[model samples]
Target: MAIDILVVDDEEMIRWTLKEALESEGYNVRAFENGRDFLAYFNEHGSDIILLDVRLPDSNGLDLLLEVTRVDPDAIVVIMTAYGDVETAVNAMKRGAFDYLAKPYSLEEVSLLINKIVQANLLKSQLHHYQEMLENKFSRILGENQKMKQLREHIGMAARTDRTTVLIRGESGTGKELVARQIHFQSARADKPFIDVNAAAVSSTLLESELFGHEKGAFTDAQKQKKGLFELANGGTLFLDEIGDLDPSLQVKLLRVLQERKFRRVGGTSDIHVDVRIISATNADLEKAIEDGRLRQDLFYRLNVFTVNLPPLRERRDDILLLAKNFLEEFRKEFSKDISGFRDDTLRILEGYSYPGNVRELRNIIERATLLETGNLIRPASLPDELKKSSDLGYVAFSQETAKPWQSTGFNFKDYIDSVEKQIVTEVMHEVEGKKSRAAEVLGLTRFALRHQLKKHNLESD
Candidate 1:
């Protein structure tokens, strides 16, 4: 859409010149002879930018600027005045003008100034949209349980700070990285870069170079000077994942940096300083590692300033369906599928089994089911065999009937448990005439829990 610009000048020549020039540049330009006329028109219509003469016959342009700004906080107004009124122009700017234009300026200068305003507004709009997208994508720390609520409070507190180092401890697949990112994106350093490195993923020999950079010819593969994650995340955040796995040699260097806010590059003598908020995550027990001489004691104390521990999905059963639905909606859009929800059998299976892999596993299961779904909802047929198996949570008991792992090629105990549980739930629901309240009373379960079970078993409709 063409940006609407209102030009208010008492001189007929000045008003006509701006209106014609801006209109030629594809703006919806309107001209007024005085502040009164401009205010009258603006009351009924909306404009993106305003070009007003500082001296109006009926009103002071500064007063008019204040009025427009009061009406619309985001209003953009530029003041126009004769030469030697730079001070007045500056004062007008203090009164909320977007800019000041000196009189006797060429038409080309006018066009350039207007173009800059339009581009700035465009950039602002794009930035707002981008931030919204990031929030939607990364802000899904879903849970209705008390533990989750407490976790959210801690996250809020951590995100409000500027430079507190954070330590996130959780089992693999528990979304430690997600927690780290939420903290970074919500803090004062949100607009800065968020760099992450995994101690376990990279080789111990190369981890230092990767994290601390190196000078030209620092090593055989160091063809040129390179910047480390610290430099890349300067004035931002650096996430050190699997911090417990950091090699002992690197641990000393890391401690030095944490203490002094400086480091010497791998094979480089010059000390590099950085202002980085370190957020470290580890699935390992740093305390035990410290005792075992694996992790440095001082480093653990430094990084453990604020610790956040995420619960396993099985422990937070209330969030299973919640997370499943979230993943469902995400995959629905990603795969462009019409899949609505899970079927009765599928829900029971999902709820009954203990997710040893936690939330990440559930998401992967849902993703796979979504892609394989041919109907409007996911069913037991769409679920993996392991999910449908009725194991004693751990499924640790192998088939005694089939001898051991060597003798049996195919045997499953989880299948038997699943069928038995499904049958019992199905028959109970039938006996209650599909009444959840009556079923819960007979089965010795709470209505809240019964509802989740019913949904898991695709017995909600019943």
Candidate 2:
């Protein structure tokens, strides 16, 4: 990487000389006539290192150094002075100068100082990058809703150590991968690689080779020696998605790897030992599978040391509008649209619908709406079939318990009353698609009376 160096001196000769010398050494150099001049330009033209003179017309070098630190504390400062006083150099060093270069310094001495500063800055930058990547990788779970807040707290507790095996369970579109990423990125192995593989996506015939790799010419397709994800992810995280779909034989092999932290290649005999943290995700009902003699009980127990269950989007009604608005803004920029916001009717429709596909479905809806919408708002025409159907149906009580045909045939009088109430509400909403004023006018009732019926039925409108 090229080092950016700034030269600050009142003397024109010194400024030009340092810039020329530094530029000749393949460094980006900027020159300022005085401390004030440097500060004025620093906001626009910042550098990794600043070579500052002790005495200037506007300000002292040490004071300038303090100011620069305030702007960017990581910046390296090397003080230069013609006074060549050991006491003054020591004081500058005490005030956070990386080093002090005496006036009339040789080209070799200047080059040496610049190289040292560059090396130190490079190391600091690498450390910062590692921390930043870890933080960024786990930033997908930000939310104030109760479910996400609890999930964050659970992740925090699990990330306090590296010994725990994490099992993330959620619907296919409920961000299972995001939760797994949070566990690994926040753990001790954050500096190492994070390898992800979908167990169901890879064919069972090739999964063993994919996880354990193969030696060159070991099989017809094995033309070259390949490193498996486990070996590649050594000292880091190995995220296995759709893990419940892994075949029984492959599950045994994976269990062995988890137990021994070692696996043999597809056609090789040597066992490769790797230090990896396993984070697995699955959308299937694993307990039912185990009961049906499908999944191994021991393996399930091994992987479920710490479980995090993500609530689907429908369960977190409080986050629907928040997530919808975020998606709207994201797509607005992508599609180069100047959409202001979702129409109130559109938002109402979103809040009432059951998002079977969860956040992923919501994003897709917003993206499609933003691309198709010509006006500033997302209208009812932009909503999907499920949402539009729900709006027309108004508020039908969803029975948590599956309904039986016998119960439907033997409906009580109260059930008929409920059905009648549902019919009136649906007619009103169907006439106006849930606009309170229009629905109220059609029903020959005041808006307040219509709202009273809405409350009785526990219904909201789009």
Candidate 3:
């Protein structure tokens, strides 16, 4: 792999010698005499590696190292210092330099160090890229929740095969898109495009053309041939959000494509075969739709080859605080605020309310609170009136499950224990919106133990 290396030193002879040696070793080397020149070049075209001198005419190398690292934390910085200037080089290293080299170093020694640094940088770059992708693309999905953990496992299993047609069912804000994205990113066609189409957003007249393309002069607006989402997502995945909202006629067309893997443009004769995966999501119950003859049974079965149900926030009360924290961190960065955390009473309110809108609602609440919070902690007054009212005093009473065993009933010890456990789990679950992990934390129980108790009580989640 070709490497871009910037060598900075006040001495021309050292720069020329090092540049020549590195160039001979097949690296693209650029040299600068001062920190100003290096900074200018870095601003124009960033280098993958920066070699800095500890003592320069313009500025100290430690200061320059800090600037470079701030500009690109992933940049590989190799510092140069005199034998006694090791202390300054060590300081640079502490400030995020990859390594340091003593002054009057041999050309061969510099070449060897560059080679090792470049190779290490390449690996780090690859790892960092994957890490960024995973975090940015999948971090919203906190797999600590039991349902999310199971969904993740299912996604892994489905990614290994092409026959899996996943149907993601959930409430409006339950992160159906996130689940679909996870499937596409983990599948064999991860490198390929993942096309998203909102079936509910398009009109019945245009939805067909949007999914299966349209030839020139196919309709009044069709000025030229246009590729559809299916063609765009050829080898990858096509996420059909609100698939249940597709028009009845379009449902027939979609069903045909699912069965035959072939579709034709609106005005074209030849069939276009696509090796695409379909991951559809909807808040509607397709079985009921089929029973009402609004959706076809064959198509429902085809899409439901594999199904993943996402529980609403109210159902996963244990995850309420965790999700709140995640949202708080995100909003804090978004709004450039330094709000530390939620107040105990604030958290109490958040945990008590049933998030009818699920994770999406929680995100909006955190965003609003982060922006409104003038102090270090978020207070209940920062929340909407509806939330505050619902979660005020009544919520505290409903949510508190930390009473001693002695507080429970005395009649029938086993039955009393079951009742207490059920009540505690139920209350905590309500607080966390059915998030088993957070509920378990609130109730002082393990996730596995909570699941066991939940099964034991046969109690309904919030």
Candidate 4:
């Protein structure tokens, strides 16, 4: 989309010059003679960038700047000031103006400012795309279990508010990040950015600077000014994962930002204020960490305004087969396979095993099974060895040596062994209705190992 520039300069010549200059550069430009008409137009239709004269005929320029921000806190504004009023221009920047253009400036100056505004808009566009994609990806959480029902209710209430600090607790792979993303995308600030930062991923020395930007030459690698996640996530959500890994010093800094909503960048003196909604997640026990001097109790209280604890997959077993079948069908379509469905025995095998890796692991199992399917139904042979072996625990009905074993029908030893192998493999396959992964599991062998035995015994389907 073309950059929409709103020029609110009072002088007829200035507005005309800006309109012509910006339009010549392929921008959509609108010029107003006074602040009243511009503010009214803004209420109806918003613009990408605004150029307001510091001394307007119909309104106080500073008051207009304040009102513009109140309408859109992330509004990009450039104040137009007289050459002698440079100090006032600086003050306007402090009041959230992007920059200032001095009067008597050439048309070339207008072109330069437009280029800068265009570049900034491009960045905003990228951020908006990312936000939209995430919100769309997790638009709905899949589960009909009672736990999931309660979780949905909590998310609805939390998203209604704009700036509530949310602390999400869940075991790893329990969809904690998904919950956080849902809250951000469902909230009033969904149009803004959702910046995710893993606290444990960065070193303590650099984590502070990464969260709160640093000035130029702040550190050895600080070659230029940088904005931290907090600054970039202004008017948006900051999803801090593994938050228990935060160091003590950074924890103090974070507490200050949560309480005062302001902080100084690294090696900077000025307090940069921001409006950021913090959503922190961690698998670690914060209470134990606090007792061990790893987490501060006060910071915990500030962030614990609302707590969301996610149930693990083991605890939510009712959703297991539902999720598994859904994943199976999805992978079937993705791989373009003709596998009809899971056998009843196959579903029993799937439900019997404990999923230590949770929903993520279950999805992976289904995907692998779907990709390897070469038959009508997903049988026991399609399952992993770990699951089958674990499922067969405590079920050694008899020892082959002690119990009645199949007598040799012929004198050839190799032929008899091959016949026994074929019989056992075929029986296991029939038991689970041809699910290869599950059959391999039940026989205490890998799918690869079972397939080799099948081929060696001439039991493989043509």
Candidate 5:
């Protein structure tokens, strides 16, 4: 897009000079001899950069600056005046002028200032784009289940309370950290820093100093003063993962900080005050940990002001395929594959398995399958052996001795037998690479009998 520059000055010579110089620099320059003409043109066609002289025939530049800012708060207006004084410059800036230019200013200075503004605008645009991507990536909690809906509602409530501490409880790999991040990014402190640490990943000796800054020479390795996660996350959020694994001794210090909003760094005497929202997550059973003395009860109460409990994947079975397809699309783009969708049998296998590792495990499974798949659609052959073995059709077993034929109102024995036989025959054929003799051998049947079974089950082509 071409940059538009507007020059408003009562002096014809100055207006012509600016218009010529700015047009030479490839800007769409428009010159006006008075504030009345400038305002009329501005109301019709807005410009990117505005140069307004204070000594206008009809109006004051400071008053015009207020009007421009009132109409468009982001308007970049540069004040131009031959009688430039400290008070006039300050007044222009107070009225929302971008900068002040005294009379007899060089074109070089104007070019430099314009370049700086352009660069700043470019950076602002890039930052806005990235922020949008981040919000879209983390804000979505992909599930239509009632539990998930309630969880989102709880997250919104927690985010509204800026100072409240939040504790997320869930099984490992059930998106505890994801919930913590969602709360932080959706809150009022979204623009500030968000730092995260795993309590279990750091050693007890270093974890204290990691949470709170230390003075120079405070310890053997402390050569310089260092700020900790708490200080860095001031006015923002600090996500502490696996909070149950924090050392008991440090828990006392943490409790004091929560209660008093101040803490002394390791080997430091003076207390440092900070305003940080703490969002902690733990997969461990906190009630059990409190009873076993592994976690402090007082600290638990402080961190548990707002709690979000995530449901395991098996309980919300309806969302399994939803999450799976989402992961598949994500991986397909990442791996640069041409895969379109999952096969019907593959979808069944994905939806039937109990995900012990939850969403993270399903993501990994999709990633691996997307990378390894050779066909247009994701088939059962692309899945892991464990998934295929544990699929709904994989474990079917029927015996006449123990069968209750008339148990159901509309039971059809022949149909049930035929379905089971067809599934077994299909699985055997897949295992044997569609070799009828090998499939028959595996099923304990002769070639003729296997052929008859294949024709009956609509597997004649195979």
Candidate 6:
């Protein structure tokens, strides 16, 4: 994208000089003779950079700068002033002008100022692009289940306000951090920082210093001053994962910060005020913790202002296939594979299994299947052994240890035979510790035939 430069000066020679000079630098330059003509063009098509003469024939350049800033707060305007009116140029900068150019200024000076502005704008553009990508990534909460629909509504309500503390309750792999990100990206503080830390991942002493930084020489290891997550996330959000594991000593300090919106460093005397939204998540039951005296009731009250309870995967079985398909598409593009979809038998296996690890485990399953699948569609052969063992496709009653196949209603003979063959190959490979040549000799089969069997059962990687 070429930078568009708008030159607004009453003098025809000045306008012509700027247009020719900037155009030679590969910029899209447009010139106007007066403020009225410039305003007309600007109202229709905005420019990336503006050069406004301080003394326009129709209007004051300062007033025009205010109007431009009011319309577009990000507008980069450089004030063109006379050498005698240096104070006016300074005032222009205070009023949001990017910089100033004095009359009798050389074209070289103008080029240098424009280059600086271009570099600054380039950085801002990149940051904005990255922020947009983050928002897009976290905004997707995929599900069609009723609970999921209501959960989305709850997330929206939580995002509508900036002061409310959010508590996300879910199992370990159920995306508690993901919900925290969604709240942060959807809120008014979307452009600000979103910092997170796991309360249980660090020791109590270190976690204290991590959340509320220490003063210089505050302790034996505190050699220099450092900013904490709360201070770093000022005007943004700080997500505390596994909040239930926060130490009791730190809980008192955190409660003070939440109640008063202020805190002091570990050994510092001065109080530091901050405006940060705290979003805490945990897999433990806070009510139980409070009863057991592990969690402070007051702190729990403060953190639980807005609660979002995520449903476990087993509770919302209808969304299993929906999430599976979404992950399949994601991995397809990522792996550059031509997998069109999941086979019917594969879908049965996927939908039948109980995901103890929830959505995270399901994603891993699909990712592994997508990589191992050799055909146009994901087949049951690509699934893990656990899923096959528990699948409702007539394999659940077959006992590998006893070599017994129990007969049941709606049992498919072909699937039963395939399961038996897969189990035998799996057991033989496991017995030999995945040494294919030795396993082939034990099974009285050729090496090529063993390799073929392993591929058929999707155990080639093992």
Q: Which candidate achieves the best TM-score against the true structure? A: 6
lDDT per residue for candidate 6 within 18-71, as digits (tens), equals 887776555789998788888888988888999999898899999999988888
| Pairs of residues at least 3 apart in sequence or in different chains that clash in candidate 2 | none
Cα-based TM-score, every candidate = 0.59, 0.58, 0.59, 0.60, 0.59, 0.60
Native RMSD of candidate 6 (Å): 14.1
lDDT of candidate 3 over 1-462, digit per residue (tens): 357889999989989998876765446789999999899999889998888888899999889988988888877888998754757766877999888888777887886787567445544554455468686622547737787788778777777777579899998999998778777767677766676889999899888888898876788977646667787667678899998998999888888889999899888889999888999999987888988999988889899998888888766777888889888887888788989998776776687677768899988998899999999999877999767544423333344553333342332455434544555666677557678888888888887888898888775444
RMSD of candidate 4 to the truth, in angstroms, is 14.0
| Tens-place lDDT digits, model 1, residues 1-462 | 347899999999999998877765446788999888899889788689999888899998889999999888899999998754768888888989999899888899898898677656654664475477576852478899898998888889999988889999888899998898788878888766777899999998888887888776778976546667786677778999999999999999888888999998767777888899999999887888999999888899999999898987767876777888889999999999998898754654576556667898999999999999999989777888766653232222242321232232333565555555654666577556678789989889999988887777565772
lDDT of 4 at 375: 90
lDDT assessment of candidate 3: 0.78
In model 4, what is the error at residue 187, expressed in angstroms?
A: 0.8
Spell out the clash pairs found in candidate 5: none
Q: Write the per-residue lDDT of candidate 5 for residues 274-368, one digit (tens) a residue.
A: 89999999988899999999998999999999899999886787788789888888888888999999986677667656666888888889999
Q: On residues 111-188, what C-alpha lDDT tens digit does candidate 4 reach at each position?
A: 778666655665577467656655543234678899989999988888988888999998777788878878887888
Q: How many angstroms is residue 259 displaced in model 1 relative to the true structure, after the best TM-score fit?
A: 0.5
Report the CA-based lDDT of candidate 5 relative to the real structure: 0.81
| CA displacement after TM-score superposition, residue 143 of candidate 2 (Å) | 3.4
For each of the candidates, the C-alpha root-mean-square deviation to the true structure, in angstroms, is: 16.8, 15.9, 16.6, 14.0, 15.9, 14.1
Q: What are the Cα lDDT values of the candidates?
A: 0.80, 0.77, 0.78, 0.78, 0.81, 0.83
Q: How many Å off is the CA of 291 in candidate 5?
A: 0.8
